[model samples]
Target: MTSVYPYLPEMIASFGVERKDVAKWAGATSAVFSVAQSLTAVPWGRASDKFGRKPIIMTGLFCTMCFFLAWGVSTSLKMAIIIRALQGACNGNVGIIRTMVAEMVQERELQPKAFSIMPLVWSVGSVFGPAFGGLFAKPAERFPGLFGNSYFFNKYPFALPNIIGGVVFLISLSTAMLFLKETLHSKRHSRDWGLILGRRITEAFKDRPFRRQQKLRRYSIQDAEASAPLLQTDGTSRPAKAGREKPVAPSMSSVFTRQTVISLVSYTFLALHSVAFDQVLPVFLNYPPQEHTPRNTSLPFFFSGGFGLNSGHIGTIFTFYGITSGVIQFVLFPPLCARFGVLRCFRVCVLVFPVIYFLLPFTVLVENATTRYAALLVLMICKAFAVIIGFPCSTILLTNSAASLSILGTLNGFATTFSALGRASGPALAGLAFTWGVKNNMIGAPWWILGFIAAVGSLPVWMIVEGEGPTAGSSDSSDAESTDAEEEAVVFDDDDDLLDNLTTARRGSGREQQGLLKKGSEDTRNTGYGTVR
Candidate 1:
């Protein structure tokens, strides 16, 4: 996604789009990808549910790598859109990644920090992503010293960035394939050919005898114990049972309970406005430099041209935003969520967005270069902080709202669909608004409109009721019905605990099958809920 951002306008313009229509087409390209994402996120999510998390993740990385390379050499707008749509359709790892994280960090106390990891990684990527998109873009011109005479860089000005992206994806795919363990409890012990083959090759190279190697293995005894029949509480050994009943996927009606619906709706609105702002930033930066008028009292009703930065400069500014945001997220988000509560912090963050949008257009109004840049920096910092807080909070809330782990993939899939629709609409509408505004001499129209949308988005947070974990009791019947008895929760820091627990999953161990430790759920509920006022 970051591979195309910095020079999106130039990229679109190269495809024969009129200068006036480049932004519109750029928005269309992004919207089309999200539209495709909306169509397939559910299926990909369900695939993760049915197959396993690791495989699905690997699949997304591979497909994205291939399609991103296709994106680099696009000859036309339609071709670009087609490649982007294909990319979105083939990749659905986002929700699955969240599901896997939530399962791995089942302890609610750790959720704030745990959930922050994904967005934190995104922030780190944002730092490098735009750098890749910008500095490597049109390298023949940007770095005439090195690539001025090179044929490949000269012929395909934009391909280098995406080539870099594809390499990054390849490395990630290899890493996941070799080391990422499945988090799904049902599939924990399931055979993984990639891991199995990798292990066999490593084992084959060992100089020690097989008997000595087996004796030295730490898990060998544990695996043997797990394979034997589980001992009952009364010291009697129960026969090993066949595959335990797979928990049925909850019906859609059941999954979308009041709290869950609220979470999804709020997330949709959050994605809508947030993505619009993100989409607008690049175009806003790449615009031709215009002299700022001294008549700044017109407020948001009147606005003129942008900072007119080149892709390299834009990349540097974005890198600053990303680095600072990542630091703030890493340093502050967890403690704030822990102290003030996740939902409360999230609600406040959402409320601040409208004001941020209202103030955004003013950045272009300052005529003095030094003052203007300082103001822009402050605003960017504020935006970075709010976004860092808001996103992880949303993830934690939505994750806890799942009816059961058995239904988490489907629920997340459905939620992703809502988010995708919001993302799809954001750019399309913002693009149209931007075009109209630019033509009509109301340059802030899109920003102001998004501000209004942000205000409306804030309304859903008021209606959002936090989802509770299993030990969390409520007088509300809705929450009671949300629980599923058969989906026993087990808190393991890693997959190595699988063998020890497998010995406890016997016919006579129904009571032992309940969540091994239920403290995390209650702690999560208490810490994550609070009044914003």
Candidate 2:
């Protein structure tokens, strides 16, 4: 996205729009994409629950391919907007993929490790995508020695990046088709072949015979009776009562407890703040230092307050950020999570956002280029750390908050929908805010606004109550207490049953009963406790 930021003015100008409206159109275009994504994220998540994770993911990949192709060939800003929106509508895979990862790792303790893959993978892609866009975009124009006078290159100067992006998506789709596993329990038992062709052929061969032989098994009361070996009954006394009843688990409705609600709200706010920051940063960085006088040309440049970087420069910076982000996600995050625990780690990360935002504008104050770059790099690292930390932790907490395993899909879907809302609003608002700040000659205004948002967003994190321990999600407190009480009561109940059976045996034999009674009385006197007697 940063790669394309440098070209937005050019892209907009080709549509014959006024220069002043570029920011507005940029924000609008991004909003359209988010709006589409917001509308479909929940539905896709629901579909993943009903169908399976792999299929949903593959569908998203296919949509991404289409999106890139169309975006590359776009003749006008309107086409780009529609294509982007289409892509968003079709590619609602974020939550579904999160669900897949959570389900993939059964052991609760290993989940953090598994979840760390997501951010790392995303960072890697972020690095590559912008690099591709920055270096490959407008290839016909930029690389005339290679693509000069070629019909394809001449007709679609900016199509090279899109073509590469599409191919990448295709490769990803192929990989998914071959290696991705179905994590949904219901879909798991249905034969999976690890590769598309093998699965198809296997299903084709199995379908006829499988259906022909399929028959429902019926339950039998006789089977139940045969399985239960009878306990002896004493005629001298009544039959022993049953053991204590087992504890019932909490209902699905119990998932919406105060802690869970607070976590969700906090997560949504975090998303809003994080995404807004991300959207604003690139624009701020690419913008030239503030200009005192109007220029003859309408090309984009940083004003006095901006970084004044080209697309390639911006891409290089993002590449650096991405590499560092990957390291932090994979190497640093797990230990941090282990050392500080997920909630504390998340809270600390949240607190860092405001600090990062506040410090970001200060980079412009540095007079030396090298010093400014160094300072900016450090700030970017901190920002990446802040951004990456909250997501995985929030995902863990969300999974933990599930009322039942069955409802994980629904809960994540709801989370994705809320997140989509934030994503949709953030970029648009950020663009507008930056534009407003620049036009009003208050360059720090956007930063200040963002800082406030981050600070306010952090407040909700305090309300999230961490679970007791690793086994916290297994059951609730009331159920645990009930289970303990039931277990304690079972010993007496078993003794009563055994005593009744002994009494029945005594009743059957009169001489034996008298002898046994005498022995029992002697034993009871000696032990001063009930036993076989």
Candidate 3:
């Protein structure tokens, strides 16, 4: 997916197509692709929630394989565009995959490791996808009989790679179908598309109160011990029959609190800047006609050859940045959050990123090749560090806020929707910004503008409270200590009374009372507040 555009020039030239026409086709196709892909996530997620994960995932993969095959066999540019749009619509696995991983992994501590592994796989895919595309995207003399006399082979030099991609997609689809187990526990599947889509949209808007009510009825009976059977006492008594009725626990509707909305907007802004810079930085750094030569010509060759960052050494450098950021997020950010708290960690990152952005322009001033490379490396490392600091903190803030709203999945969808919006627009915005800057002879202007934007974005985060010191509802400082002591005293008193009651019931031979106590403990455990000690 990442390398699709890299073959645009070759595609235009080989097909004898106008650059403008090709650009328009690509732009419209990509826009439709993005919209369809982004909008499909929630409904797919909802479908997985109802129809079982394996079936939904297998269906998606099968559709994806068909789309890839269509793309591989495309003869005309219009056909290619249609195939890509269908490909986007069918490839709604992002949200489903995340949900599956979450369901499969029980421990939160292991989540970062699982998430990290996916990106590593994707990075490998990204590197090889382009490398293989470039290798296979040559004239038919290179591989004469492989795709002999096919329209795709004649019109599109890159047809081989697409064909291979289609094969891979089919293999993946088959593998998933054979191995993947159902994760969703729902007894009833939602066959109605209208109802499914409506529910998804409603959930996105935090309107799950009616669903909660339906669930609550089932839980209310369970909570009231309606499942327990009545016992009859005759000579050699037997247990009585159970009630047919069960109380349902009411489902609570999630409210979009102000704090959650603010966090979402803030994250959207940050993502806009990050995605824009990610898309544009390589283009800016690798602009044609290299003005500066390295002191050691072998350095670029060595690194580029090893990493396969063919956009000069810049791509390799960015990969390093990505690797560093991922490592830090998995290793460092969690501990920092545990110590200083999520909000404090978030503010610190917000404060630091602007400083890194401000320093980026200085790379242009270093005249010595070694020094310049060193500076660029340091700048990239700092940017990576800022990302490490920012991303997890932002996630923590958003998740915590969502928890308060009691709608974690819907809130996450809202955040993702906005992030997708930013990603969709970021490249165009950067292109315009860069063109304007260059036209105005402001070679160094982008950095300052980025710095100012980052700083402004940070301001909203600071307005939100850092979770430390003597803030209300916090378990920090002497007040919290005193509160903890009181809580402990109450807990001890309750335990003592429970023990007394148990002892009295034993002495009185009242088994029903003991049974009630056991039921109460079980209920407490289910509520997630059970104390081990």
Instruction: Estimate TM-scores for all models.
Output: 0.83, 0.74, 0.57
Give lDDT per model, in order: 0.73, 0.66, 0.50
Model 1 RMSD to the real structure?
A: 9.3
Any runs in candidate 3 off by more than 4 Å, and if so which?
A: 1-33, 58-88, 91-93, 100-155, 159-182, 185-255, 290-342, 356-366, 403-409, 443-452, 463-533
Worst 10 residues of 3 by lDDT: 299-308
Best by lDDT: 1
Residue 492 C-alpha lDDT in model 2:
16
How far out, in Å, is residue 402 in model 2? 1.0
TM-score preference between candidates 2 and 3, better one: 2
Report RMSD (Å) for each prediction in the order shown. 9.3, 14.0, 13.3
lDDT by residue (tens digit), candidate 3, 63-182: 877776666556666776677667766765554664455445434454345444454454455455545555565436456776556666776666676677777777776566444444
What are the clashing pairs of model 1?
Answer: none
* lDDT digits (tens) for residues 1-533 of candidate 2: 32234445445556777644555567667677767877888788778777777888898888778876877778887788898888778766678887777665646567778888888888897788777766776777778899877888677666787788788888888888765667664454343444445344444566665643321111101111111122222112122222211223234366466666787787887887787776567667767765344442121323336787766777778778888989899889988888888889899989998898777776776778899899999988998998788889988887776655555666677677777777777667777777776776555556667788889988988887765322345333345346435433211122234345446657866887767655544433442212232
Candidate 1: what lDDT?
0.73
Query: Which should have the higher lDDT, number 1 or number 3?
Result: 1
